[model samples]
Target: MDINLEMINLIKGEFDIHVLIELPQTMLHANIFDLNANLNEYDSLTSFWPVAGKWQLEYLEEYFSGCESVHFVIYKPGSKLDLIKTTYKVLKFINKHKFDYLQFDDFSARQAFLLPFLKLNKRLILSIHDPIPHGGEFEWKRSVIKKMFYGKAKAFITYSSFSKDLLRKTLGLDKQVVNLNLLPYTVFRKFLTHHTVEQERGYISFVGRLSQYKGIDLFIEALPTILKEFPDQKFMIAGRPAFGYAVDSSKLANMASSVSVMERHLSNQEIVDVISKSKLIVCPYLEATQSGVVMTAYALGCPVLVTNTGGLAESVLDNYTGMVAKAISSDAIAAKILDFLKLNLYQDMHAHITGDQLVSKLSSSNLETLSQIYI
Candidate 1:
């Protein structure tokens, strides 16, 4: 469905909004992180840099049709000389152009190291998705360099309240902070509108690259108890594990009849295929912040059962959309999972989850907020 949502409100001011994203071959069709990729900031006008890639025109016409305001200047530079060359190209381009406001959309390796030291005259803003690296993935040098990166931005935007608060305490700045909710990844909208999965809804899944803070092992541990009651209940674990972490093939092998694991990178259509068929998505995080996975589940009209850590609990409206585990233990997770199934909450949640309003509202709110601050 190429549903072109007409925004109810246009930002009050008139300025060219330029969003910068320099990463390794990331797609506007893949995520909501490239927020401006599909959303318009101005009520009736849209503008793009002369150098905008012709390849992106298809995505714009299909998903971003009739939208106004922000235009993304995405430049992905290669290693060594190419990196230096493209860095200068981007900087020079910025100096040469006249965007009323420019925002670095997210943290990228090259941007973090080079952006702070550059001498550009334009107003700059940064949106930090992860204020700190997850528990086991931290490094001292990255932290030091990241602090310098934090110092350059004139304003900050975060999707999670937890990250906004932590960034303040960690960086000691509070003014010009904007907190907005993450929008559902709409890359799946077309697939969902056309095809429907044939499987009866019983699968409960853990999606996303398996990482230490993600608590995949805890989710596995809680499974036996859930299986004891709903003996035929299905379980699916998707996505490749991060470095130094592994999912035991043998551990899940015992319950082979009921478990399905896809340990590799998943395409956008494949993700929609799984979440759309499943009744519940699980995010058993042991630590905090926000989740894009939870947002995807909402898009598919599938409810989630998340651990009561970070922004996971805050993201789910318990008893309606989904439920949060009382504690971060296997037993607590199982208990909530059981409650959701026993009460037959899936039917009501599935019916209520059709995501059109939620998606449009998130965009509308963020655009309005940005208009106020960027002025």
Candidate 2:
């Protein structure tokens, strides 16, 4: 669901982009994405699966198609023997092809092995959305290892200047960094128009995966104070847990009686419906680079109340596009929510962040900047 449909639309015409994904052989159980849907725009699609044994391979051959080259490389999940095999297979594949450029959206332990293949660093473009680590030294050490291991890339791209600056200051990256400012994610535009009922409008929402760094806990903690002001107001927490984090549904019981919890991963249509039903989307992140949730809110013309950390504040124009918290504390978040409601800022913001406005802003400028990387 994080696939930027807007970015896909922008680059599909000019770029022959291939998608490399790690998935099970049969996508029947895949919840995060549908490999077959909306893939006609891609040049090729390759999946790395765990034990693509004889039967699984046959199932993949039959179930998956439309990709120019439907290929699979086997890698057993959570097993050292298979990880080594997968690494070697992936390295061999990389060695065989010569790409014009490579853009890394993330750099983690899973990708650490591929860093050494960066002999031609100039053809590599590092896209660091969250440049600084959430924790202290451990993350910093990992980042340094990544930078030194990969060496310097030809260029860097980020969603906001705040993240780009963080990359420069924290990682000492001096490459040509470009900010593809505020690209609209209209993946659910049609869905919103169809499924969103006008009568369902008006609840304060926290949309996206519930992670500690995302500060959904802070938003939950702030709910008591928020409800004191608007007794009839309902607060909806709509999203599943992020990777290793579990959102304890039991805690919702102890909280205010009006808090609605949608603790499952929502589809694109469901996400649009939740966002559309809300008067304001709140992101109480303790740290962030850029928020796709905020962008999604903007795309739907829904105003946001975000914490003033990292690029969250930068994403909003403060009182114009959205409101930012005074601080990251529970008290600060509650105060901002109440204050935002008092001012009645949604109508003004909704008028400003229109689909046409985002399209105009996302057009030639972003396209030119991204096209330059290919050049």
Candidate 3:
């Protein structure tokens, strides 16, 4: 149950913050929180597993004791009773400690479930991370503002300008909303290790879920044309497949030998390694809300070739950091890849955003802004 002192110190040193709330172990790798873990054999679906809960509670209590202000970041949906109970237990403990801020990631669900406790605390920050508009006219923004109105929190935070615009234009709540984009810390470090820039590795790498919307099938379909031009070029596919959208890897491999698929969950370190070694990271998503992968790729100085859909466009400046292909089309993806290969600007772009530069840009200052919202 012991907390990592080094990690705590690192966070404190970077942000000049005393305490941060850590959720119980349940939410860390919980099946409900992450759909990618559903198919894994090691995933435990049962709620309130005695050992994990006990250890997590003990660890979190110790961690909270050391910090000045503990901000709890909750990301679970409202359906699970066990999650609710666990959250309540944490909240009660935080109440006793008189923590500085209580932050909830899902505005509506958190407001609904934690309304009783949150109503008493005027320091609560109800936040949302809706990357794409839910229905038409950014229904998610309206829903969030409604939640904020009901919850009566100190402030609200969101991730993108699209959502921020919807909040301002549709809801007329611009002053109440804050936009803090995702930081690519992992990718930034990889770029620093290489002393001399080598020739482009010349492979298309896709690092995310293998679901239908992820455009894995599109990448598979385009393999024939891609391989025809560069027979020796390889295609690396990392990350576990999403729930309910499974793929037959054996059949997929037989169809395209050039396509090297790592059909397993990769650790954060492994992800950085794969991205750093690649020529380009292909995010061929048919539809995306917000992209963590795009930011990760840019952080690693690995140019991205993404589709012109959703937040992918927002993340990758087309023909700048990377190219944007037509959505849901393999031919378009292949064309973009071909176009990218033809260009000789990889090193120039890589030099522009060094690891230290990215780290400084996405450093403690960003987290400080987030802290302001919570405080």
Measured against the true structure, the TM-scores of the candidates, in listed sequence, are: 0.81, 0.75, 0.66
Each prediction's Cα lDDT score? 0.67, 0.68, 0.58
* Tens-digit lDDT string for candidate 1 (199-313): 5667899988778889988889988999999998999999867767778777787788988999876765677788877899999999868887887788678898888887667
Q: Is candidate 2 or candidate 3 better by lDDT?
A: 2
Best by TM-score: 1
Report the candidate with higher lDDT, 1 versus 2: 2
Give one digit per residue, the lDDT tens place, for model 2 in 1-375.
Answer: 243345545665667664455443344333334334322222222342332342233333222233323344333445676566666766666666766776666655655766666456488877666676553213555766667533657787788878887777654445677888766565546565644846466889999877768888788888878777887878898887755666666666766478888887787667888989898999998888888888888878888988888887877878888888889988988988898788877788888888476467667788888977888
Error of 2 at 295 (Å): 1.2
Q: Clash totals for all models, in order? A: 3, 0, 2
RMSD of each: 6.1, 6.3, 7.6
Model 3 segments more than 4 A misplaced? 1-89, 96-100, 107-114, 119-122, 131-154, 166-175, 187-202, 248-255, 326-328, 355-375
lDDT for model 3, on a 0 to 1 scale? Answer: 0.58
Q: On a 0 to 100 scale, what is the lDDT of residue 109 in model 3?
A: 41
Clashes of 1: 3
* Candidate with the greatest lDDT versus the true structure: 2
